[model samples]
Target: MNSLLILALILFGFTSFYFGKSRIKKVTEKGDLRPKALPHFYGYYQALWCALPAFLIIAIWTVFEPIILKNLIENKIQISSLNEISQDELNLIYSQIISFSQGNFSGQVTKGIEAGAITYKNLLSISQGAKVSLFFCTIIAASLFAFRQINKNVHAREGVEKTLTIILFLSSVAAILTTIGIIFSLLFETIQFFTKINPLDFFFGLGWSPQKAFISDPTNLTPQEAKDLKEAFGAVPLFAGTAFIAFIAMCVAVPIGLYSGIYLAEYATSKQRKWGKPIIEILAGVPTVVYGFFAALTVGPFFRVIGDSIGLEVSSESALAAGLVMGVMIIPFVSSLSDDVINAVPQSLREGSYAMGATKSETIKKVIFPAALPGIVGSILLAVSRAIGETMIVVMAAGLAANLTINPLEATTTITTQIVMILVGDQEFTSAKTQSAFALGLTLFVLTLILNFIALRIVKKYREKYD
Candidate 1:
C-alpha cells in the first residue's frame, strides 16, 4: 500500500510540473508581464510542493504506526491475560503474534496467540488504509496551494533553492550525527563492560581469554567460581599483534608502492604508465576475503614449505602470511595516491634541478620529493589506517590465539579478529564475555583516533616548512 501511494505521489508530482510550466507559459503569452523566475523553476517549485509534504507524511506515519500498534496490542494482551507475564515474556508473545500475523510463525499456536494475531492483522489493515488516504489528501492540498500561488511575481526560484539547500544541510547533519551515535554507543557499552571487569586488567593484563568470564548470572558467582574463573582481559597481546601485523604490512607496502609511484610519475613511458597503473590499482578492487583465502590456502602453506626446508618452524597460520596479503592489498592505496601527489609537483622545480646539473634520481630525491612530502605523508597515513582496520586476512591467515610475540613466523591475533570471535554467536549483551567486544572496539577506536591526530600534526609541521 505504501509503495503504491509513493508511486501515485510521483505521478502527481510530474503532472504538477507540466501544469505549472504550462500555466506560466500561458500567463506570459496573455500579458506583457514577465515571470519572476524561469518556467522550469516554477515547475520545480510546484513539483516539490506536490512531493515533499506527502513524502514527509508517509515517513512520519511509517515511524509511528508500528509504535501505536504495539501499544494497542499490548493493551489488549494485558486485558486478556490479566498481566501475568513479565515484560520479556510479553515481548516474546508480541513477537509471536507479529510473526503469525505475517504468516511466518512456525510454533504451536494457542487461542490467545491466534486472537492477538487476528487483532494485529485487522489493525494493520486499518492503519495502512488511513496512511494511504492521508498521504493522498496531503499531496492534493499542497498541489492546489502551489498551483494557486503560481503567478508572474511568485519567487519560484528562491523557494526551490531554499528547499534544496535545507535538504543538503540535513544530509550533512545526518552523517555527522550518525558518526556521533556510533561513538557514543561504543562508549556506553564499554562502560557497561568495564563495570563487570576491571579497566586496568582489560587494558594491561597479558592474557586474552574472555571465555573464562562467561557466567549464566554474573551477580551470583561464588567466590571459588570467581576465583577459578580467570577472566583474563589482558589486551596487550591483541594490541601487540595488531601493531606487529600493521608494521609488517607497512614495511612491505611502503617501499614497493613508493618506487612504483615514482616510476609511473617520472620515468615510465606514457604507454607503460597507461597500462601499468591501472593493472596495479586493480589489486584494490579484489575483495579482502579473496586475499584472505589466498593467504590461508596458498601463501601460508608455501611459507611453511620454505621454512621447513630452512629448518625454521613456521606455524600454518602465521602473522607473516596475513601481513603479506594485506600489504599487497594496500599497495594500490599507496601507489595511486602517491602517484597523483608526485605528479602534482610543479614542473618548474624539476626543470630548475635539471638546469643545475642534477640527475633525475637526485632531482627527485632532493627537490620533487621535498615539495610533495606532505601529500606523500598523507597517503602513507591512509595506508597505515587501512592496514590497521583490516580483519578478514588476519582472521583467515593469522591464528586466533593471542600469542604476544614479535616473530612474524608465529601465530598471532589482532583486536579486529578477536572482536569477530567474541561476537560470533547468540550474545547476552550484559555478559562480560559479549561486552568485551565493545571494549576492544572502543580501544581500537581510540588508537585510530590518536594515529590520525599524530598524522595531522606531522602533516601540518611539514606542510608549514615546505609551503
Candidate 2:
C-alpha cells in the first residue's frame, strides 16, 4: 500500500508539472500577461509543491506509525494481562504478537497474544489508510495553493532555485555529519584498542599474528601474556606487504598509463581518439573482483609455471600477480586523468615551442609535460590511493600470510587483507584480536589522510607555478 501510494504521488507530480507548464504557456500565448519566469520554472514549482509536501507527510507517517502501533499493542497487552508485566516481558510479548501477525510465530499462542495480534493488524490497516489519505490531501492542497499563486508577478524561478539550494545544503550537511560520525566511531574504538595493546608495539612491532592474542584473555593478562600480545600484532608485515604491492602496482601503472595518456591526447587521430578512449575507460568499469579472479586463477599459475621452467622459487599466490593485475585495473584512472590534464595544456605553448624550432617530442617533453605536471602528479597520487585501498586482488593473489618481505615472488598480505581476515568470523569485540581490526582501520585512515594532504599540497604548490 505504501509503495503504491508513492508511485501514485510520482505520477501525480509529473502530471501536475506538465499541466502547470502548459497552463502558463497558454496564459502567455493568449496575452493574459507577460510571464515572470519560464514555463519550466512554473512546472518545477508545481512539481515541488505536489511531491515535497506529500513526501514530508510520508516521512512523518513512516516514523510515527510503528511507534503508535506498538504503543496501542502495549496498551492492549496491559488490559488483557492479569498481572503487571515488566518492560522486557512486555517487549517479548509484543515481538511474539508481531511474529504471529506475520505468520512467523512458532510457539503456542495465548489468548492475550491472539488479542494483541488482532489489535495490531486492525491498527495497521487504519494507520495505512490514514497515511494514504493524508498524503493525497497534502499533494492536492499544496498543488492548489501553488497553482493559485502562479501569476504574472510570481517568482517561480527564484522559488525553485531557493528550494533546490536548501536541498543541496542539507545534503552537504548530512554528508559532513556522516563523515564526522565515522571518524569519531573509529577514534573511539581505536582508543579502546590502545588501552588493551600498547601503541608502540602496535605501530612498530615486527610480527603480525592476531591469533596468538585471541587465545588469551585481553581483560586480565599475565606479564608474559601481555608481552606475547604486544609482539603478536607487530603490524610491520602488513604495512610492508601493503607498500610492496602498491609500489609494484604504481611501477607498472605509471609508465604505461602516462604513455597511453600521451598517445591518446597528442598522437591519436580523431577516429582513434573516439574509439581508443572508451576502450581504455572500459578497463575502469571491469569489476575489481574479476581482476582478482584473473590474478588468482590465471596470472598466478602462469607466473608459477614460468618460475618453475626457469627453476626460480615462486609462491602460487604471489604479490607479483596481484600487483600486476591491480596495475592493469588502475590503468584507466591514470590514463583518463593524465590524458585530460595533458590535453588541458595550452595549444599556444605547443605552437610557440614549434615556432622556436622544437620538435613535437621536444615540445611535449619540455612545455606540455611541465605545464601538466601538477595534474598528472595528482592523478598518480589518486591511483596510489586506489592501489593501497584494494583488497580483493591482494586477498586472492597475494595470499593472507603477513610475511614481511619485498620479494615479489613471495606471498604476502596487506593491511586491508588483514583487517578483513581479523573481522571475517564470529568475533569477541572486547578481545584484542577483534579490536586489532579497529586499530588497523585507524592506521589506514591516517595513512590515506596523509596521502590526500600531500597530494593537495603538491597540487597547490605546482599549480601556482604553472597556472
Model 2 spans > 4 angstroms off: 1-5, 27-31, 60-127, 151-153, 215-219, 425-428, 463-467
lDDT of 2 by residue, 161-259 (tens): 999999999999999999999888888888988988889998899988888885455678788887788889899899999999999999999999999
Alpha carbon lDDT at 111, candidate 1: 95
The lDDT values for all models are 0.90, 0.90
Q: Cα RMSD for candidate 2?
A: 3.3
Go through the candidates in order and give the C-alpha RMSD of each one to the true structure: 2.6, 3.3
How far out, in Å, is residue 113 in model 1? 2.0
- Cα deviation at 425, candidate 2, in Å, is 4.5
RMSD of 1: 2.6
Q: Candidate 2 has which clashing residue pairs, if any?
A: none
In TM-score terms, candidate 2 sits at 0.88
TM, every model: 0.91, 0.88
